[model samples]
Target chain A: MDGWLVDLVAKYNYWIYVVLMMIGFYAMIRKNNLVKKLIGMNIFQTAIILFFISTGAKKGGRIPIVDYEQALAGAVQAADIVNPLPHVLMLTAIVVSVSVTGVALATMLKIYKEYGSIDEDQILERVKNHEP
Target chain B: MNHNLPILVLTFPLLAAFAVNLLGKISKKHVAPWTLASLVLSSVASFFVLIDVLENGTFKYTVGGWLPPYGIELVLDPLSALMLVLVSWVALIATFSALPSIKKEMPGREHLFFSLYLILICGMMGLVITGDAFNLYVLLEITSITTYGLIAMGRGRAPLSSFNYIIMGTVGACFYLLGVGYLYLITGTLNMGDIARLLPPLYESPTVATAFCFLMVGLWIKMAFFPLHGWLPNAYTHAPAGASVLIAPLMTKVTVYLMIRIIFSVFSPQYAFLIHGRVQTLIVWAAVIAIVAASLIALSQRDLVKMLTYVVIAEVAYMVGGVWLGNTNGLTGAVFHIVNDALMTLCFFLVSSAILYRFGSTHFKDLHQLFRKMPITLCVLVVGALSVVGVPPTCGFFSKWYLLLGGIEAGHYGFVGALIFSSLVNAVIFFRVLEIAFSSAGEESVPAEISGSRETHPLMIPSLVVVAIALVVIGINAGSFLSQVIRVAVPSL
Candidate 1:
């Protein structure tokens, strides 16, 4: 039990991401307001981003920068440097999440103008009633 | 120049999208010409790329001269090459019809609409050709974001539908990203080829299996596969006629293409089919339900566009089920259906656009004596409907034949039953529409202003005629096409 606990604690980052993702997923599906749904989407994306970033971290590694003289000599040690690919990939993901948030907010603004409410139920009712 | 054909197919539209936006501000007249010219160039390049791929076999082009496993690469095999030609030509043909429809529907917004249209094309083209797993996600988001914008541009409840699509699309894309992240964590590589190479030894690992599940679920959501298809119908139905002609035909089809790519390219057939044997049967059953349910729902729709949206969902199930059947014939059917389905869906939507342009609505009541009023458009509609019903000498029949053959070969009788049931339901639904259209019962009820026998815009009918002819041509030549293209496209099992 003690060893199991240690192993669990060691991989707590994965656990945290899973929890965060579920929370976001639940809100995205269950939330009534469009804004709240968009917020849930943001949280969901951030969880994935966190997961990607965590994959790049090493216990005793430095940043992915290399010494010029060491790199030219072809003696750069891979283990000493953190994996930079995931971080680079996450940077792109962050940009995508931001763009998505931007588009979602714009659509929400239009929805409010058209339906006069951002709540899902109210909007649905208006749609059903054919109310302008 | 010959070797650069792959990247040229992508860059032409990507560059033109921005050029069109900027040029539109200078003069509205420039938008159509610029958009058409770029699409023409892209289509020509894509055709040449297909020829190149057919001649030389599969090849990869590294972005910026950086090799794979580090830099991005675009891989053009027989499969993606064929898809590129399909997407480029569909967008070109659709644009011919879209111009006049946009002028009628949203006059001043043509430039913005075409801009998004061009970017969406680039994104889909990129999605088809990119070999990097992460690159596919970025392209997928690009396609989704542009689609969200295009769908929102429609009138009445479109924004709400677009919002719903945005939420669902983001979840799907993020799930895909998470799956890729998991794979990267396990294999320390993001290139699909690299990951596939590393995956076999780790096939027994729980993480690999979990990643596969996440990836499949993500793609299923994107493709609107049955249970995850909530966003597609409303979104496509509410979209403007101009946009629906493009998005309805291509978006789900491209995502299905991605699913096949992942199954065959990122994970081998042995891993996807043999190792995950139980899941394969379960997915095929799920597909059966998707087809039946979508067909039934389509039968109940009052509006033409809404019914066709449900039909699109059912066609998606056909392709998904075909692939999950775990045999070469099934995969071939799925790939061929992607091509057939895209063209047929485009044909149907283009007809809808003409109808919407003529009468301002496609409700059944409004469509009374449509055959008499718009004979040319209605003729093309019959051709499309016939194709959808799996009538012979049309493209749809050939693909459905392959799918039925596949189902029988795999001994998945449920799938075969569902395909036949859906086809029968489709025939009934279409014949019902035709009966209403052919009858003169409600002729007096149509508005006097729309009572003429005039066809749609000259541009519109020609494009529709071209597509309708292509459907027949493709059907007649399915034998040669199957040998030359799809046979090569289907990975040897």
Candidate 2:
């Protein structure tokens, strides 16, 4: 039991992300407010971003940049440098998440203007009532 | 210049999108022609790329002279080459009708509309050709964001539908990104080819299997396969006619293409089929339910375009089931159906737009005297309807034939039954509409607003005629298309 607990704790980052993702997914499905849904979406995406960034971490490894002399001589060991690719990839993902939030907020504004409510149930009720 | 065809196919539209926006600020009249010219150039380049790919076979073009497994690469095979041509040409043809439809629908925002439209096309073209897994996610988001913006531009519940799509689409894309991150962590590479090469040794790992599940679920959501298809009907139905004409045909089809890419290119067929036979069978059954359920729901719709949206969902199931059948004939049918369904869906949406252009609604009641008022448009629509019904001498029949053959080969009679059942249901759905339009009772029940024959914009008819003719031409030459293009595109089983 102690060994299993250590194994589970060793991968605590993945468990944190999984818990965060499920929370966001639950809010996205269960929340009535459109803005809350958007917020849930952001949290969901942020968890993924964190997951990606965590993938690049290494124990006792410095940043990815190497000394000029070490790079030219091919003497730098890969194990000593943290992976940079996932961070770079996450940079793009952050931009995507921000753009998605922007679009979602814009769409929410339109929904508010059109239906006079941002609650999903109210908006659905209005739609059902044919009240423009 | 010849070697640059792959990247050039992407750059033309990406550059034109900004140019169109700038030109639109100057004058709205410049937007249509400028967009068309750029797409035409892109189409020609794509055609040449297809020729080159057919001649040389699959080749990768590393971006900015950087080598692969590191820098971004554009992989061009017969499959992607065919998709490139399909996307560019379909956008070109759809634009012909879309310009006039936009003029009637949105009126003054043509420039803004075209800008997003061009960007969406660029994103799809990029999705087809990019070999980098992470790059594909960026392109997918590009495509989704543009679609959300375009759909929100419509009036009356469109914003709500667009909001729903944003939530769903973001989740789908983020899931895909997470899957790619998993792949990168396990394989230490983001290039699809690199991951495929590294995957076989790690196939038994739980992490790889989990990544595969994430990828499939993500793509399934994007493609509107059965259970995850809640966003499609509302989003597509409420979108502006002009935008729907462009999006209704391409978005889901491209996602389906991505699903195929992940299955065959990023992971070998053996891994997807032989090793995971149970999952494959489950997905096939799921697809069967999707087809039957979507077709049944389509029967309940009163709006013409909404009904067609349900039909689109059903067709997506057809492709998903075909590929999951795990046979060459099945994959062939799925790929060929993607081409056919895109054209036919474009046809159906174009006809709806034309109908909406004249009558201001696509409700069945509003369709009275439609056959008389818009004879040419109705004729084209009938051709499209027949194609959807899988009748002979149209492109839809040949692909359905292949899918049926594939289903039988796989001995999944449930899938085969679902196909036949859906076809019959489609025939019923379309013929009911035709009967309403053709019957004199409709004219008698509602007073005729116009005295004589009326059609969509003269320019629109040419494109409609072209698409209708292309459908027949494709059907007649389905044999050649299969042999020359699809056969080559199918990866060895």
lDDT of 1 at B225: 98
Q: What is the lDDT of residue B493 in candidate 2?
A: 81
Chain A TM-scores of all predicted models: 0.93, 0.94
RMSD of each: 1.5, 1.7
**Candidate 2 ranges beyond 4 A from true positions:** B441-453
Which segments of candidate 1 are over 4 A away from where they belong? A1-4, B441-453
Top model number, lDDT: 1
DockQ score for candidate 1: 0.91
Per-residue error for B67 in candidate 2, Å, reads 0.8
Chain A TM-score of prediction number 2: 0.94
Chain B TM-score per candidate, please: 0.98, 0.98
Worst 10 residues of 1 chain B by lDDT: B443-452
